[model samples]
Target: MKTKTALVTGASSGIGRDIAMILSKKGYRIIMVARRENRLLELAEKLPGESRIIAADLSRAEECFELYEKVRGEHIHVLINCAGFGILGEFEQIPLGKELEMLDVNIRAVHILTKLFLADFTAQDSGYILNVASTAGLMPGGPLMASYYASKAYVTNLTIAINQELHSAESRVYVGALCPGPVDTEFNDVANSDFAVSAMSSKKCASIAVRQMFRRKMLIVPGFSNQFFVFAARFLPRRAVIATAEKIQSMKREEQNS
Candidate 1:
């Protein structure tokens, strides 16, 4: 009997690591992808099921394609796109190179990997894709983290659109977006932002994400608060939503500096 395999990006730490662990416990052979080989090795040793590690920086287009090529032949039962980062600052103050890198990892890499794997999944007629977006994506804009917010919006919208296409085609390939709010992870340090509200545990976030994703839910926002925010944003005027987002981000930035 062939073992089902799940490939998880950003598996070095945080939500990705937690998701990988949960999937491993669920009897899926895990393929961990991240830049930190040592961390991945440590995690692989602890996982209950068999695991493989691929140390590659998905922020580079070449590496993203290379990763696809390496695993294209494997029967991947699931692909979780979670390798992403964010920078918090005024759009004009942020480095263009960093913003581009963020786009590469958060959007371009996701697009490439999804396209590659979706083809395979459709051919096999069974697979699941979970793209980790953010509650920020539901907002009209984010003042301090413009690029990051926009990138997540792309991820969220893209995943939803693809899932619809798959449904219309009558394919069993499930594609969904995990839109978590602030999570208690290294992401705060990496993004250079402070949480304005209480952050949810990455383990809790991952648990909900995995369960909802396999259940074939299209947009899995982890917490009730986050879901409410997303829902309310839909009713608010676009300008008002953008203003609120800006105020929230401004507060976060001030907290980070203080």
Candidate 2:
């Protein structure tokens, strides 16, 4: 039996960490990448199988390429781009510099890493790539989280389009976009999304994602309720959906303030 290798970004915590752990348990050697060196080192030590930690801030383009170079000789069977960040507030109120940083990490970095890995996977014509988008990608969110929604939308669409192209080329590569809603991770603390109540656990979410990846599913919206909501958002009028999101955000703010 051969040990396959999986590269999981943002693996220091939350969904990425869980994904790395689960992959390791399934007999895959894991390469955990994140900005938090201590957490990544701790996770690598605890994983069931062989693992390594690459502590690089993926927001930097050079670091993204550096990671690719770091594991050049290894055969990467899976590449999971779970590294991203979000900002919540009026677009104008958010600092332009902060918005650029969000785009750099969430959109640009994802694209860079995906492109780099896809070249290798395409050459072999067999591998899996998972891009973690959010259910917020399905529609426009309220003014508070506008840029974050747009970035996720880009991820969702890009993943689908790439999957189509791969199929057309008769490549065995599988590309999946994971669109989960309000997951119970450290993400809420960073995004300041107080509406995240009874959210799905990172462990549960990653388990489903891993299972679906091997099954070659193109898009995975984890929970049934979340899937239903995404479908509804797709069919609803844009204005109506935005208005509803505004109400939800307002209620969330009240909850946080109280």
lDDT winner among the candidates? 1
- Give the clashing pairs for model 2: none
lDDT of 2 by residue, 76-154 (tens): 9999999988877778888999888888888888899889999999888888999999887777766578898889999
Model 2 spans with C-alpha error above 4 angstroms: none
Per-residue alpha-carbon lDDT of candidate 1 for residues 219-250, written as tens digits (9 for 90 to 100): 99999989899999999999888888888888
Instruction: Give TM per candidate.
Output: 0.98, 0.96
Angstrom error of the Cα, residue 186, model 2: value is 0.4
Worst-scoring 10-residue span by lDDT in model 2: 248-257
Give model 2 RMSD, 1 decimal: 1.3
User: What is the lDDT for 232 in model 1?
Assistant: 95
Error of 2 at 148 (Å): 0.4
The number of clashing residue pairs in model 1 is 0
